[model samples]
Target: MAMFVHVTSAANAPRIRRSGIRAVSHGQGDARGVYCFPVLPSYTLTHQWLRELARFGSRGGLVAVHVRLDDDEEVLLGRYADRARNAQATVPAAQAVRRIAELDDPRGWEVFVPRAIRPRELHRIRTAPQVAGWRYRPDAHGTRPCTCFGCRVRGGYGARRLRERLPHPLDGPPPPVRVLLARVAAAGEPGDPVVLREVLHWFGMRRRGPLDRLAHLAAHPDPGVRKDLVWAVAGWSTPGVGDLLDALADDPRDEVREAVEAVREPE
Candidate 1:
């Protein structure tokens, strides 16, 4: 059986194990298992861990590291560079685990195995396979702003300002944007992240309109949904936008309050 080690916070250990991987503790003395690292800002990337990982990989162990480029870009990039320098093919977490499972003896594969694409190339390629039933906007500009969770956490001013100045999709013709808004309104409590993201993007695509329906969702119980709603309204100069933001500025959740305050209009 394939053994897996997750080097993340204790809080995330349960979630990792629930995914069917036998998450072992760090000091379990099981050095033969594949080690998985999640590159989050909260996790400290220490030199000791790097050295241990290098030693493990050198001895034919698999290493799977999931990186969010929008957050801690330089740090994660440097770690990934080290992994590539060590001759480990950096594949996605899921793919890496599958490959490890298929191999009877991981050591059989050469350390410097050359694949069709390098890790850097794979990093540059952005695809939507991870998000099922979602499609990229055909008209999306390469320089267009992204307000997704990762981008927001990264806190890029250019992207945030561009998104703020853009218009709302609801202000456009009644096609996909209208259809998407309807779905968002009809969605049950605690909205879906994918749908919410697209809706927020739509809000950033057009400049004028009340978007009353979205304003109503500002009171969503989920703080994340409420935060997205705040961001959607931050760019609008339409009627009631200020009042809506004012109400959210005092939200019970600190995250919601911070998000609203970040873009709230001066009183």
Candidate 2:
């Protein structure tokens, strides 16, 4: 059997000790699982997720609840950089533990077990290294501002201004202002979001108008259109966009909510 650790707030320690970690996402609907890190040979790596969990846990000290799983148990594995549901691969529990141990530096990897960890599988609970792990993501410290708009903290101090000003090296030149406006004006109501989706890319946030023209997309039957609308509104400084966002925030689809939270102001 391979061992893993689930880092959580101290407030949860007691309940976990009594009942084991449940098979449930904290709140999200589809990410149902117990998120954990495989216990590796390196102590630093084994407990690397401590700090990151505690930051959001905000329930006093943090603890690592050790779990022992059968070698044949299946689990989802992925880079921590991706969203929880975006699994990179699924492998046996022992393989995940063995693979991480073999890697020189598997810094951003994480594991997710799909079922409840029974108390019998709970090996032990202990204080984890509070200083371990990365905040936000592994490359965040002293790195260039993340160019992927969805991944960065948009509401952080000066963030909106910074995103507006800087373009990543890999980005192609944005469309000419006149051309972007013309595209929006010329755009027709298509059943598919593909046409308007391309127009949003032309805007690139430099100019913020034509809100009335793009408003229909907010409630389009296609969720891709709704999500695209959220991304487009994120760049513009126009009014009515918030109302659009408010409507989309309540969308039933997980992808739509993910887009809304990605750009929505920090609450």
Candidate with the greatest TM-score versus the true structure: 2
How does residue 15 of candidate 2 score in lDDT? 90
lDDT by residue for model 1 over 1-267, one digit each (tens)?
A: 111222223343334334423333232233223333332222222111433333222323322333222221111111222443544554544444345445543321211112111122122111111111111222233655455443332333344454456523444322355776776766655677667766775675455555676776777766777787778777877788888888888889998899877775476
TM-score of each: 0.33, 0.57
Residue pairs with backbone overlap in model 2: none
- Taking the tens digit of each residue's C-alpha lDDT, what string does model 2 give over 42-81? 7878887766665654477888899999999998877765
lDDT to native, each model: 0.45, 0.75
Q: Which stretches of candidate 2 lie over 4 Å from their true place?
A: 26-31, 81-87, 147-149, 154-267
How far residue 114's Cα lies from its native spot in candidate 2, in Å, is: 0.4
TM-score of 1: 0.33
